[model samples]
Target: MNPRLPEFQTATATDEQKTILNEILSGPRGNLNGPFLGWIFSPQLAQHAQRLGAFCRYQTGLPLRLSELAILVTAARWRAQAEWHIHYPIAMQAGLPADIAEAIRVGAEPTFAEQDEALIYAFATELYETKRVSDATYQQAVGRFGHTVVVNLVGLLGYYALVAMTLNVFDMRADGQNSLPFAE
Candidate 1:
């Protein structure tokens, strides 16, 4: 798919844009791609989003594995090819089961071996599919991970959903690969 926006170039960037790009480059992400490329159109928004995303992806209360699982679920729910491609390997590196990530990529319900993974999958899937999570699922998440983690989980979901929407709206392709595993 062709991108609706042009790629950001540092050579032509204004001072403010250069600052924002510098901030992103210095962060843990090191370099920008995917949604960040689109975000450069609004430097301030990109700055704030980068901070929030850093927290969600790195500092959230949930383990990296569970957080990546939630992200995978969000990517699958939105069929965000860029997101899936970017995070699939990270999810695997974080120790998420390969079969589970592949299942989510293919739009199948993954059978999770870990209870925490199962809970996160259920929570994210229920929210994405129905726009609301059942009380039982909510309570299970809260009981297991506490309210702070639950709040972070919801924030993570909403944040990634926004990223997915941006990637889809602008037709961002991951690493020049245009195919998505799941059907629209």
Candidate 2:
């Protein structure tokens, strides 16, 4: 699928856009792609979102496995193919079981070996489906991960939701993968 908007043209970038672009390029992302392609049209939003994303993706207290699980849940909830395609490998590398990921892709209940994975999956899915978590789930997450990580988890979910929206709206799919994780 083609993107709804043209990719950002560095040659025609405004000073503000250029600065933000440079920051993004120099940051952990190291490239202009994904939602960055859509966000460059609004440099201010791009700047703030990218900074927040940096925190959510890298600086969050949640361990890589937990963080990736939450991200995959968000991608599945939103049916954001690009988000799924990009993070699936990262999640696998972090030791998230392929069976679990495959379950999420197909909207089945994943049987998790680790208690933490089960907890995260429950928290994320509850929050997305019901718009709020039950007290048991909330207490479990806070007890397991602490207040700071719980907060970061929420922020991470919100940020990824924004990414999913951007990708879905602009049709910014991952390159080199043709099969859709979700049926259209």
Candidate 3:
């Protein structure tokens, strides 16, 4: 687990919130201080992470729905409150149902309208349960999403899994200033 803040904590951000602040203001966020933060602070993880963002955003073309689904599952599987807390609203903004996001926060089976969401949840569950997905599930995903999306979905799971673990390992918490799922 790495230290939460990089030395220059924001004026409004508390030390408690610094855990979450590290993620929001620095590291990945725009208001960065140090040369590297979050993934950048970790050179080894950065190589894989940079490629992962590209893979999820470009290679997959998964859109926000499936991407959010992949992220939420990774958060829940790892009990990562911070990741779940932030992505909860982002997922809804991406068009996922509020009910589904809430269910995911507390570790419940999520209902879905998008076929890709269901498939992603299934894949995440399978991976968490057995450490590997079955051939039938893989085939179904490939058939439904095509090979490129399937590949990126896998990447999404892996990338978000890294995020969840990183947050958890560092005891990261949410910045409380964030709004709820449907907040305007």
Among all candidates shown, the one with the greatest TM-score: 2
Decide which is better by TM-score, 1 or 3: 1
Error of 2 at 142 (Å): 0.9
lDDT of 3 by residue, 1-184 (tens): 2357464434754454454434434433444321224555454455455546545644577777778777888777777666777777778888888888778777778887877778888987898889999999999888887888777787878777777676656555566623322221
Cand. 1 Cα-lDDT: 0.88
Per-prediction CA RMSD (Å):
1.5, 1.1, 7.1
Q: Per-residue lDDT of 57-137 in model 2, one digit per residue for the tens?
A: 998898899899999999999999889988999999999999999999889999989999999999999999999999999
**Candidate-wise lDDT, in order:** 0.88, 0.91, 0.67
**Which prediction has the highest lDDT against the true structure?**
2
Question: Which residue pairs collide, candidate 1?
Answer: none
Ranking by lDDT: 2, 1, 3
What ranking emerges by TM-score with the best candidate at the front?
2, 1, 3
Residue 17 C-alpha lDDT in model 1: 84
Task: For each candidate, give its TM-score against the true structure.
Answer: 0.94, 0.96, 0.72
In candidate 3, stretches whose alpha carbon ends up further than 4 angstroms from where it belongs are 1-36, 57-59, 174-184
User: Can you tell me which runs of candidate 1 are displaced by over 4 Å?
Assistant: 176-179
Clashing pairs in 2: none
Ten contiguous residues with the weakest lDDT in model 2: 175-184
Select the stronger candidate by TM-score from 2 and 3.
2
